[model samples]
Target: MQIQKINLGAEPSGIGGDSARTSNGKVNTNFDAVVAEFADVRASIPSVTSDLGQSTTIAISQKLFTDTLMSQFNDIGVQGALGFGTGITNKLPTGMSQMQGTAIKGHENWGNYQYSDGSVMVYVPRFYYRWGHVNSPNYAKYGVNALDVKSIYDFVDVVAANAAGYALHRAFYDDGQIKDGFFVDKYQCSNNAGKASSIKNGIPLSSSSANAPFSGLTGAPANTLAGAIDAAKTRGSAFFATTIFIQRALSLLSMAHAQAATSSAACAWYDATGVNNFPKGNNNNALRDVNDTAVLYEGTGYLTAGKTGSAQPFAKTTHNGQYSGVADLNGNMWEVALGLTQTAGSFYVLRTSAKASALTSGATLATDAWGTAAMTASYDSLGASYGELTGVVRNFAIGSTTNQVFSTANSGLAWSASCAGIPQLGGAGGTNAYGNDRFYDNRIEHLCPIVGGNWSYGAYAGVWAVHCYFSRTNGDHHFGVRAALYSV
Candidate 1:
């Protein structure tokens, strides 16, 4: 017996066939057709044989019937049974290729890829988020209401749309097809020989060296940010650690902590008394992981003396407390974020040309002086437009009466939230809830943004920390660099 085809015609409209019914026509004919199709299906079942048990005969008949029915359907039916085609292909973005490496245990979302210079990169897929208070008290005080979660693309599109015609916007949206996510250095960028690398035991490159690696002024090896970008641009994709990229990285890491909480309760990461999900790097004076109580340096003397990227204690310094998340985002060293500048008490995202000038200007914001706006307007605009994306207000000033401070008692010091949407400035309240990550800014000087607190910051270093006190040309030993790749 063979399975017969049943023609249902044009879906909803033809599902019931004719509305008008006559005793010998329309509905009767439709019923007859359906009954005939059922009869064929019933006839397809094989009879139970004496040699074969009833269960075995029924199983065989079921398989035959299923095979015959499935054969009449489309490829989707076969693919569904085989668990094959998903219609979504996993393609490596430009400037990156798949690498065969030991899998990071328990982290299925993370994978290692390679750049042209053979430096390793970790791929982060895109995600969505919504705003909710960490605790009921925070909700009552801040009056933050829950919002609908949206994808990273939704946020990027808004930024691109709001800041159209700016290089900052283009650098973020036009650089690559980031809708699928992007690549970031597996570890803080290290100086290997004369090139930038992301590997274990290599010395992290300083921002001073990163500005002019071959200047001959600094004795450090050549590992400029430009070189890192060029090395990752084997396929001509934009590759650099821009503010937007760093913000996205922070967002991805914060997602785990943020989504773990109920709509009305505090998130695990945001709970003042809860376990800190963000990793503690070499932020204390002892050069140890404060969270894990592990020493980061062994018999240390100075930079690269006994300390290097992904060192034993530093292994716990990743964004996710594992090798999978971006490493050293909490401390160890401050990483430079390009394309953002604070000039004369205001903030402005630089143009592509201005970004280079920022690296060269030593005394002033002159060369990078195209866009400057008042903090009041800029802060309000940023907070109103994209603040919710991060689940926190941008450039929030900690007040004496406000419980937003790390300690409910301390006050008077103003602090800003990091891209991940957490405030870490030190105040009368001791350190802010997240980590003692501090934000430093000066109204009288032109400064560039350096993120993640440095070693010796003790109780004042975190992923949400940002320091705007250093000029683009003023790089310190504690200033380091991280690389990113935008792929299509």
Candidate 2:
């Protein structure tokens, strides 16, 4: 049934030219017309179903109904509304702005999303890639592949399918609903009057004192790592960036760099000579490039440098191009990742709690720390599952000549069997890998993972750089953290 507009244009002329009364026959005809129109309108209205499995007749106008439906789909409180689930919101979150034009070219489709508390987050839309063996001779010995591009989903589906069993896909799920994507802090988290922030020119926070920001919140210990986790949580729907989160970001950046390169041979994280694809950052005190001949930036120093800039042709410090990607991921402060811990020469994923006191005591992990038992069971399953044991890398020897790629023959360093084909785990050696950042680990003590070397690390600062030398209680001024948001 089609409902047309009812046009009651003018009042009927009264009988004998009087405006008050109408003839009985005319009144009856008008009443009949009105009844037919209303009946057609009623038939045109669609039925809607409720969550309780009951169908209800809606009598509101069509525009009103549409507005209500859109509200439900855009509700941020809903599990999948903002993430990978239903619909993307046109309304930007507070302090956020969408990137346009060349800034979002290729696989670099993302937006700057800021939290209410001033944490600048970059929205990393979900992308898929297949693991392919590393082609560069510098990285071939490590026996891992680079992340090859498969597909990137820019427009999310209403009923989005879960990305199950894929690398780093577990972090995209929150409470069983698959998220469209996640947000990472654009800069290393800074101290904003004791709260965790990701703003430019803010002082980066790192301290072993019990007075750290967000300390004692939710009964977490006063240590920097625990405080960082609590501080992020206090920002609402946020957590300290986890190893999975960092790994996923790196994977996306790797795929972006590969997709933009002129030759497939350049698809690896680094170029032919092992110079890393991502920016070298402020690793050197002079802010020079890998060759030490060109000055990368003219900033005062690492402590007071701006968060975002273009030191080179692209953003030398950001994960993407100039001012378009996440910043300070190479050589800034060392960002600590939660959920990654190493002890007795094996790495384990910590999923349950972020409380330092409960998880660790001095350099030793508490016996009952969560997820330890399952990770210890099988070696093959280590790199397969989320929150399971990931791969293990043999320690690199200290010194200039020894700080190159992991060579099974020369350096006696090797990646565990489970790490095969994983991107960013192993790559080329020497200058091609960006200062050939060395991976440091200690087999004896319980250690947390700190990635992205600090200033003065020179060739030792990069996206793949990993350091497992610090305990939860030990903190240095160079140690920092980044926050990530899921399902928001």
Q: Identify the leading candidate in terms of lDDT.
A: 2
Model 1 misplacement above 4 A: 1-95, 101-109, 133-178, 208-237, 244-248, 255-275, 295-308, 313-315, 350-433
Q: How well is each residue in 1-488 modelled by candidate 2, as lDDT tens digits?
A: 33233334355732344221233334434444544644434444443433335554544465333433333322212110111111223545444554442122222322555566667676555443333335432233323333333223311432231232123233444433555566677766655655677776555555444223334334442555434555555455435444434443453454335334533221212343333454556677555555433436545334533233334533445554334367666765677764455544555553322322122222323332323452343111223222112333355422122232221210001222112112223233333423355556553234556787776677777766667677665666566677776534
74-182 per-residue lDDT for model 1 (tens digits)? 1111100111100011566655665543132223123557766667776554433223335422244333322122333344554452232111112223222333545
Candidate with top TM-score is 2
Computed on alpha carbons, the lDDT of every model, listed in order, comes to 0.42, 0.44
Q: List the residue pairs that clash in candidate 1.
A: 134-266, 406-432, 407-429, 410-428, 410-429, 436-460
Quote the positional error of residue 461 for candidate 2 in Å.
0.9
Cand. 2 TM to true fold: 0.57
Candidate 1 TM-score to native: 0.55
